[model samples]
Target: MNNPHQNARMTPLGRAEMVRRIVEEQRPVAEAAAGFGISRRTARKWLARWRAEGAVGP
Candidate 1:
């Protein structure tokens, strides 16, 4: 599978936005990942980072 993280190069704020839209706003991670053109695993990693730093990681 293609690595979205390697291609997108999303910043910390962009990653945080994706995670918040999925986890906090009750959106689907798969759907969000699709929108962002990233893998679910990448999305989940950003979510974990957000949880760890309270919205400050990439």
Candidate 2:
């Protein structure tokens, strides 16, 4: 079976970098997801994980 999260890559970006791109660079979640070849939901999940744990998520 194919795992949806697998498509998301779960690359675990650095907290500072993620924050800079989301907050300062103001890149849309959908754009980020497309760049990573994933879905917007995946991008939002990554953002949430970053906010909660400061990175280090799957």
Candidate 3:
């Protein structure tokens, strides 16, 4: 199969940016999600990762 997330809207770095937008830029979770073209829940998941691990990715 083609690489997973090859057609995805955002990459791992994008998720980090999303977390930055929420934490550093003070953007709302929904607004961050909308800006990144992802769902609020997905944004929250990344934000949660940032909270729990202070970083992005596995």
Top candidate on lDDT is 3
TM per model?
Answer: 0.73, 0.60, 0.78
Error of 3 at 14 (Å): 0.6
Residues 1-58 of candidate 3: C-alpha lDDT, one tens digit per residue: 1233667777767777888888999999999899888899878877887788776441
CA lDDT scores, all candidates in order? 0.76, 0.59, 0.77
Alpha-carbon lDDT of model 1: 0.76
Clashing pairs in 3: none
| Alpha-carbon deviation at 53 in model 1, angstroms | 1.4
Off by over 4 Å in 3: 1-7
Clashing pairs in 1: none
In candidate 2, what are the lDDT values of residues 1-58, reduced to their tens digit?
A: 1233554454344323554577578988777667666677766876786667654542
* Model 3, CA-based lDDT: 0.77
Residues 30-53 of candidate 1: C-alpha lDDT, one tens digit per residue: 998888888999898887777777
